[model samples]
Target: MPELPEVETARRGLEPHLTGRRVIEVRLRRSDLRWPIAHEVRELLPGQRIAAVDRRAKYLLLATAAGSALVHLGMSGALRFLDAGLKPAMHDHYDLLLEDGRLLRYSDPRRFGCLLWQGPGTLHPLLRRLGPEPLGPGFHGDHLWQLARGRTLAVKAFLMDQSIVVGVGNIYAAEALHAAGIDPRRSAGRVSRARYAMLAATVRDILSYAIERGGTTLRDFINPDGQPGYFEQELNVYGREGQPCRRCNARIQCVQLGGRSTFYCPRCQR
Candidate 1:
């Protein structure tokens, strides 16, 4: 599934092409994707001008006067901008016909993604309770530390909680924790405030750098232009299990935490 950086990249890539453009048509190849396509999508979207493209957590929003079209690119899903004359592929599920004769297409081999509607000025349920954006002002060490008090969950699991901080998924969580020198299995309540501060900084830095590098390379994820992300080459411990640690020359180890595989350097990440 696409995480924060990946979704942000898609938002950035789509914004230029979509902003101020008019949706001349709403073409739905099918009636559902992961969930049933909202009625407003077919009724309210056609002829609406796209005002902006924004992201919240891992969701993308196409804002317009009528409302916002909420999109979630689940595993193996992608959105692409293409000439309207081009033929649709087998997996192409929908398109937004633009006034300029271009189109924005959505395709998903697994059909796990979603297309929902959010009425103007109202928050969708999927987004209402989400924690602060990891890259936003509301997130910090103090925030994580405050909510983590008395929580017995593993620190890694706590960090991955959407209510604690949105978009710190498995890949970035492992990298951030490794960078902060925190073991994934440490009790969340036992982590020191100073260490939490360090973890928060690392999380911000890693996320910013990953967004700059076009997000981590994953089999199901590709940029709007169909390019693979370049950040995978720079990862320290996320997928380097049994490999020599770049910092301490120790073997990188892997363990399952919260049912997800976690990689860390035993010597470097205390």
Candidate 2:
């Protein structure tokens, strides 16, 4: 699944092509993606100008007067921008025809992604409870420390909680934990405030660096131009289980924590 940096990359890629453009047509190759693409989307989108492309957590929002179209790129989903004449592949499920003769297309091999709506001045239920974006002003070390208090979850699991700090998915969480010298298996409730502060800063730094590098490379994800992300090569842990740690040459280890693969350096992280 595309996480925060990946989704944010999509938002940035689409912003220029979408903002200020007229939605000349709304083309649906199918009626549903993950859930049924909202029925009102067809009624609301055509003829409306795209005001902006924004992101909340992992969802991409296409803002317009009618409402904002919220998109979640689940596993194996990609959004590509193309010239109007190009043909869509079999997985291409949605498109927004632009006045500039461009088309923003969505394709998902697994069809787990979503297309939903948020009416003006109201929040969508999908987005309402999301914690502050890790990259946003509301998130920081102390806030995370407060949330982790009394929680028995693994520190990594707590960090991955969307309600604690949005968008710190498995990959980034492992890397951030590794960077902060926090064992992924550490109990969230037992972590010191100073350590949580370091963890928070590490998350912000890793994610910011990821957005700059075009997001972690995933088999199903690509930039709007079809480019693969370059950040995977920079990862410290995530998929490097059984390999030597970059910092201390300690062998990296892996375990299942919170049902996601947890990677860390036993000697360096604790």
Candidate 3:
């Protein structure tokens, strides 16, 4: 699945083309994705001007006066900006035809992506209870420390919680924890404030770097420009089990924590 950085990459690529552009055509090649494509999307999007293109967690928000469109690029979804002359291929599911004769195309080989709608002054349930954005100012050490208090969950699991911090998925969580020199197996409540502070900063730095590099593309992820992100080349411990650690030269280790793969350097992270 596309995490926050990957999703943000898509948002950045789409924002320039989508903002202020009127939707002259609404073409739905299929009626469903993950869930049914809401009827409001078909009816409200066309002729409405796209006020802004924003991202909350991994969802892409297309805003207009009439309504807002919420898009989730499920596991294998990729959005492409195609010329009007280009034809839709096998997995191309949704298209937002702009007055500028461009198509914001959504293609998901797995059909897990979604198109939903929201009305004015209302928040979608999927987005309502999400924690603060990891890249936002609200997500510093003190914030994470407070939420981590009295939690017995492993630090990796706690960090992955949506209510504690949104969008630090498995890949970035492992990378951030590794960067902070914190063991993924530590109890969340037992982690010191100092370590948490370092962890938070590491998370921000890693995520920002990934976004700058256009996000890590392990599989099936591409920016809206159809370019694969190169951040995967910079991973430290996520997929390098048994490899030498970059910092300590210790063997990178792996284990299953909370059913997700966890990786770290035993000698470096304590």
Best by lDDT: 3
Worst 10 residues of 2 by lDDT: 217-226
lDDT of 3 by residue, 223-249 (tens): 888899999999999899999999999
Please report, in order, the local distance difference test score of every candidate based on alpha carbons: 0.90, 0.90, 0.92
Q: Provide TM-scores for the models.
A: 0.96, 0.97, 0.96
- List the candidates ranked by lDDT, beginning with the highest: 3, 1, 2
The residue-by-residue lDDT of candidate 2 on 127-189, one tens digit each, is 888899898899888998888889898999998889888888889999999999999999998
Q: What is the lDDT of residue 41 in candidate 1?
A: 93
Worst 10 residues of 1 by lDDT: 217-226
List ranges where model 3 is wrong by over 4 Å.
none
Q: Write the per-residue lDDT of candidate 1 for residues 1-270, one digit (tens) a residue.
A: 777888888888899989999999999998668998888999999999999999998899999999999999887789988889899988999999999998899999988899999999999999988999988999999999999899999999999898889998889999999999999999999999999999999999999999999987767678777777878888999889989999999999999998999999999787
Q: List the residue pairs that clash in candidate 1.
A: none
Model 3 local distance difference test score: 0.92
Go through the candidates in order and give the clash count of each.
0, 0, 0
Runs of candidate 2 with Cα error greater than 4 angstroms are: none
